[model samples]
Target: MSRASLASLPATPPVLAEFDELLKMRELLLAEPDEATASAVMRRFWDICCGTTDPERVGVLEAAPQYAVLRAFFSVRWGIHLRRLETLASREILADASATDLSAASMLALENYRGIDGELDLLGESPAHNAVVLGCGPFPETLIGLQHSALVGESLTGVDRNHEAVALADAMTRRLCAPRPTVTITHADAEGVDFPAFDLVVVANGLTGKTRLLDRIHRTAPPGVRVLVRNPTLLARMLYDHVDPGPRSGWRVTERRATTALSETLLLERGEHA
Candidate 1:
């Protein structure tokens, strides 16, 4: 629909043309109405966005009004894709107590968090204590990965607003994980979590109102408590929210590293003066 503007407007950039292609592919995905076809369409979209080397191209797209519509559409679809994987994984594991196999998507997600776990290792003694992951979804891969990597200390708690997700995550973790590092999944809002109770706090990528949550943590959590926030990078900006803790956000970046091709992890602590 917005493709007409690309031709009519004066000197439309290549990125705007790419945006038109993305919209067309989105419509194709809708017409197909199947996961395989949808996945193929999205892969093309991903390649187009990810292949762009210039930051200005992304900036151009972000400045366009179509960016909001495209982001809202793709973000929701991405969540749906993940929920599908999570649902499949949960069903299999729940059907058989001994089943441990997870979806490829789930495995890749675990791998991503494994990178974050290594970044946590850089935080010295911070991640060695109690840890909590906010907005852990149906799979809770981050929590499971941390426990498996031995990054968590006495306890690991996952908080999700969805009751169903909490139940599924709790069951999956209990069935799969060992008992040494106690794991608990609870239904709660990210903003209401007791940030001071844990030495390490992880903010999941999908968590909304991150500014408000970070503000709460900054105002409430102790100085030594470290916050690990997941942020999107490159083309991931289309599907995930970017967390920018500016100089005045009362938090300082301790470590920043890419956890995956599309995502990065940021370790933060209270600023020296804040």
Candidate 2:
């Protein structure tokens, strides 16, 4: 229920200044808050992202503000509005809507797709066709893109803990993926998902209880199955839980690729002899 977590990175004074400005805005909104007003605040932050082109700094500055603004708007409303936002955003992408008309949800679908698409090379030589996407939300955009891209196989599976999200994504999948019927959507918690012998598993960002999910994958997935964890970069990590990839976690980071200016994905495998 929190947004804009304090990331412990070395300070960039100007970006820090922007964060302060965001904090001030957050303060005012929290004092007198409503969905419409909070949405307006989100629009201001989105404008900041649109205007800033410097990848080096934009990673930290832009992501933080967007997270803060959206958190203000939809802190606990997890059903209709959130799903609507996701559904519309994804449908716009599928419909090829112009950038000017995209709402916050649509913009997010674009961003997440673009980022995941950029890292498609991470699956190199690893038969990662049968993919299971953890935390598949209302639209399952990542699964859609992966299905279209070369990263996944003929079959794709989406798993989510929320039944509403599962139902919503399933309905969208049936409608969105019209030409093909290769994607399967299931309702299950990340740890308890009865995974088949999949070749790859994609852990989407913002999944609740992420560390335990990783541990479950390590134990439950097939031997040599590759796991990809898409995570927000240092700047956006303030709002989400950070899952480390290294020796202690029984996973080794094989490839680290940037998903967006402010986010990254890592291709990993269980350590040898783990």
Candidate 3:
């Protein structure tokens, strides 16, 4: 589809310049009398903007002409990739299918998490860490994969308000993972739930009270706990003015990793100090 909101974003001077170039490219594509040439240009643009293997490599694309345009274009592609992954993760969890048979969307989602884990590992952190997943959907196959990857430990607990989602997650745990790790699924709105102390917290697919819930989690969690979020709307908001919940909450804008075609993923870690 279209991500004009993301494509037309207003950011730093460099980012703005990039957007301007993308606009110029779009105009050229529209004005070109030959459709084939326009298509070729578009393809080249996508390759330059969206083909980075890792986050560090992401900046490399910016060195090309119209860097902002290419970066913005790729950012949109990354967002789309994340949405597809979320859908695949949900489907695989609900259906309990083998990973080999997973849809391309699901594969991308898995890759996105792997990328995040890789980045975290590069920071010299252990993968066998405790994590909490908020908004565990009717199918949390992605979370299951995370557990298997050692990105999460048996101490993992998932929270959700929907009974159906909780029941489904529990069922999947019983069927897929035996003597299951400390995977508990609670049916409670994220805003009111009593979150346990976790080394990492994951918030996926929920927008309501995200900041407020994060505030509570920050207050309750120990310093240095990592918070991973994959919400498109929330991430977009962060690009503009900061969302201040007060001194108790200090969040630094981190990286945005690609998940699928319709969604964007963000990695946020709470500050070490209160």
Candidate 4:
């Protein structure tokens, strides 16, 4: 049997008492030979951790050991690469925002670190860039970053499915990004939208559900257009699947980092041939 299977042979306690239940969950994942069964168990573990059955909450796995271990195992089985990119992104946002100076809830949201800032940075760097932002939420920080970049001069157009989010993004631009480069936010589904010629595009969250968006981008993007994706796990998955080389076709990936309190931001861009 594989090492993972051996580890799953029986529930064994690690030194951390708090992680005992997590170990049991790992054992279950290991023992299951069926891919579907293992996936279901992993889903259940995340649902319990996130306090909801919604798959979106699976993002909570960043803090849950059971989910983390299962995620590692799944990555190996599926030939995926795993990186703590989101963890890093959250740290940078908090650091930039001085989240430690804020309340607990605010810290939590910032710490969630979904790669919004890094995406913004890419969008900001590409003037006259046509971009699509998936899972663009109500947070104004992303727009703020874009505005700051534009102040020095950068033109960008953005699309999102959430009308409210689009409106908020537009409002943020007017308030924070005014008197400079142009920015437009519109409501459109990521998978179905008509993309224009752009130097760079970004997909923030929606890793699992948004892979299809890549096809849409490819169809509309000009040759040699740059694409930046934030999800580390998805990046790993793409690499493992041998989808295509990136960072060379003008595609690149960068990771954001922060302190233990997740109150600082750092970016590391990885280059690979596409």
Q: Give the candidate number with the greatest lDDT.
A: 1
Candidate 2 structure quality by residue, lDDT tens digits, 1-274: 3433433434446655666556556566657678787667655654554445565775555455345544444333323344566766655544653432223346656666667656677876445658888889877777767766655556788998778678767765665554442888988878787555687888887675678888878777777788888775544454345688668888889888877765678888877534
> Quick one: ranking by TM-score, best first?
1, 2, 3, 4
Cα TM-score per model? 0.84, 0.72, 0.52, 0.47
What is the C-alpha local distance difference test score of each model?
0.76, 0.66, 0.55, 0.46
Comparing 1 with 4 on TM-score, the higher-scoring candidate is 1
Sort by lDDT, best first: what order? 1, 2, 3, 4
Clashes of each: 0, 3, 13, 8
lDDT string, candidate 1, 185-214, tens digits:
989999987677787888998887788888
Query: For model 3, how does the per-residue alpha-carbon lDDT over 174-249 read when each residue is reduced to its tens digit?
Result: 5555454567777888877654567777776543567777778877877777776665332232111123334446
TM-score of 2: 0.72
lDDT minimum window of 10 residues, candidate 1: 101-110
Q: How close is candidate 1 to the true structure, as a TM-score?
A: 0.84
State the lDDT of candidate 4 residue by residue for 49-68, as single tens digits.
43432334434433444444
